[model samples]
Target: MGFLNAVGNVGLALSVAQVATASFYIYLEWYAHGKWTGHPGMQEMKKIAENISSSSFSTASTSSDELEFLRSHPSPEGVASSIDKEFRRMEKFVAFAGRGLTSSWSGRRIVVTPSWILFSHRTTFLPICQLLGHLGAVVVGTRCINNQIASLGEDEEQERADPMLGSGVVMATIRIADMDSGACMLSFDLPASELENFRLYLCCPLVYAQGVSLEPSIIQRFLEAFSAVVQENEPIEIPPSMELERCIGCLSNQTSVAIRRSCAGECGSCRCRPMWCEMCVGRWFASRLAQSHVPTSEWVASRVPCPTCRSLFCVRDVISLKRAQY
Candidate 1:
């Protein structure tokens, strides 16, 4: 479930980032074309400029229609071509920013580009970084790297030897600051593969967590706590019955069954079968909810109703069956 949520967020971030990049360029184009004349401040500035020019030389006053023409007409061909080139460059830059998350780059030193630094202020960018960090990438902010380099001195070699650096690693350098001192924090390298399952430290939105301390010990504790919570909440597996080939809900001979109702009481008066693959059951549940006029918040009150008998079942009544063969 957590993995799915992370994947969904990544897709969403990519979409939003693309739209924002396009909007930014569109605004720049508008500014360059004098479309900003619609603003009262711009009109005042234009009047001042005209007065200064008229006093020096008897020039014909520009008309509102002329101003409107300037705003609507395209700039010179050279200027239009230049803006088109810039648009392409901006697209490439946006793609490069998201490359770390969508593609694997092993053994490469990922530097924070100026474009990324500028866009990092957007809310979408941080989540993309956080998701990548959670997926075993080592993110080193710009401030932290500067601080670490400044303090190198005699410990430079020692820092290099720190077990964190390893081959085929995805390392990211960012800019983060210390909460209390407002000073840039120190940076460190890490083996990306080793941190694949390390969620706690990466899930905290470290990029934006100005209030939280970034000390190694504190980060270690956070990881430990997250691991404990995950372990405690892990669902127990139940042995499958002989009738696993057929879905209890639709009696369909699907190859994979995602959910199994092990508890009899939860079925209540429902005559529908208990075994169900995600697709079949999910559609039924969604359709049932869609037909109702209830608010989304209240839909959960209905629980997961059995498609056949309309009996409600709590989430605990069902267990997800793994498709993997032990």
Candidate 2:
């Protein structure tokens, strides 16, 4: 009985130690960012928000750590006001949108003032904001290829396309490190479009003054594959008898794309009429691939399902609809 009690006590202690160690490391990551609220597990939270592609923020808060740091010097309010004005004019993005976890999609929003680079998120209460003054390096998070373009249930044809094909930028993660310590301070994922704005806004020697080189992200070269594949097929013209309707996806634009199964793959015959715009349909296809954790580069080469009918289709099937002339 004494030996058994000793073994059990030791096992309990080890288990408690492991749990404490894990919780400590988790808290450290959050502390490194700031005293922010709502702590979600980093890796788990990333999976939930990984597909959010686009810019999201342009405003600043007076309570930010940067403001306090700036105030430590002379003429605090003056500096803060100037920074605030510039930040407002800069437009915001949906980078890790709080509402996005439930619904809605948005992307990269990083504001650069003279003294600091502001990173903010849309939270329930005061937006969880942070500031980084150090200039370090940036790196991408992730890529692929195409082969047997198979429709749903065509396992033999779906050989996981060439992993090397396409620009290979699925969900690009931009890792921003600190200059002083060379430690990663902030890192987030952004879609292809928002990356353009990121490079443009920070085009200066200071960003790379520490001899930093950036990792390749969702550059246009990678996106050109998607565009090329999408453009490979011609648009399908609608007859005068068929009336165009608002897109079900956006509910704003007229339905301009039709999914008439034209791919050589064994795609199911979709009888549904055109009810989606080209952009919405394309985005929907991309989102489907992303949500499935598939490689972004194999997008055009891969087959997808019709947004409405669930019938399998490929990029070639997405035909832009044009009204017939009288």
Candidate 3:
């Protein structure tokens, strides 16, 4: 009976110790938040924002591409202004131009401006992190098959049915790494047609093309074959009567490629007229290779079907169409 009582006391002591440790951790977190020191926790983020806003303001004041809002829109005279107050500009960019990817229900919602990128939790909408700039960007996943959204309203249904749906330029995960280090600081899925938006603001090099999309992509030169095929194929002149239409793949760029079999292989020829742009078709080829579960080395030798006609053709078969002289 005494031994059992002693064991109970030991258990009580361990529980007390755990509670004390937990309290110490909570105290440390509170201190890390700068509540005790009376200093801002986000000093570095604030400074980065300030620097970007000041630089943008100065450039707008000097350049021909000056924003009209800075002049007509009034702020307090002699008071330093911050771009954070350009709420309308930021909102407009988000609504109309669509700068970044976001989620409504859960996970992080991101917003990117020329000045800074903010990631906030969907629940509370409080910022998770703010990035002023990035070193380089890389995209990973199946992108060879570009899936144009059939209906914007049915996007949710489509995603649920086929998780591999590739909408817009890329249906892939994008990871942004720090300038000073290769460690990924931000990772997000690029929304449909938002790839160009990322390019416009961030202007970061595709680490994938630099052979750094994956750790193995560097040694394997994963993107080299796909890139080479597109660059090497000479442009085909379009007939004067043939109208240049919007690319079926991106629904944005003009259709500039036709799948004309120019290779010496067993691959079938495509009868379809130019329906995809150079970039989109290349992406389609890459997507096929990605889905094949084959090594990147074999991708260049593989054949892909035309998005419309379904006729199989090698990468070399994609020829850019030169707009007729009008």
Query: What tens digits encode model 2's per-residue C-alpha lDDT throughout 179-262?
Result: 567776565444444444444233122232334334554434444555566566776767889888766554457887778877
Which candidate number maximizes lDDT?
Answer: 3
- What global local distance difference test value does model 1 have? 0.36
True lDDT of residue 178, candidate 3: 65
Candidate 1, after superposition: displacement of residue 325 in Å? 8.8
Name the candidate, 1 or 2, with the larger lDDT value: 2
For candidate 1, lDDT tens digit of each residue in 1-326?
A: 99999999999999999999987875664454656533333333354334334433233222223223323432433222332443444122221222332112122222222111112222211211111111122244222221131232322432222223322333334334433345543333323221222221222223423342243432243334433432333343435543456443223335333333444453454444445554344434433443453454454334566644556753334444443434
Off by over 4 Å in 1: 1-243, 246-273, 322-326
lDDT of each: 0.36, 0.50, 0.51
Ranking by lDDT: 3, 2, 1
TM-score, per-candidate, Cα-based: 0.21, 0.35, 0.36
List, in order, the clash count of every candidate structure. 9, 19, 3
lDDT of 3 by residue, 1-326 (tens): 99999999999999999999987885675455644321232343344445445543444312211133333333322011334543335221231112233222134455654333455543222221122333566774424223332322313422211333323333345676765567866665654344543443343444443442323232134345555776688878776887887665544578877888888897787888677776667666665555456676677788877766778998788787886687
Off by over 4 Å in 3: 1-224, 324-326
Error of 2 at 214 (Å): 14
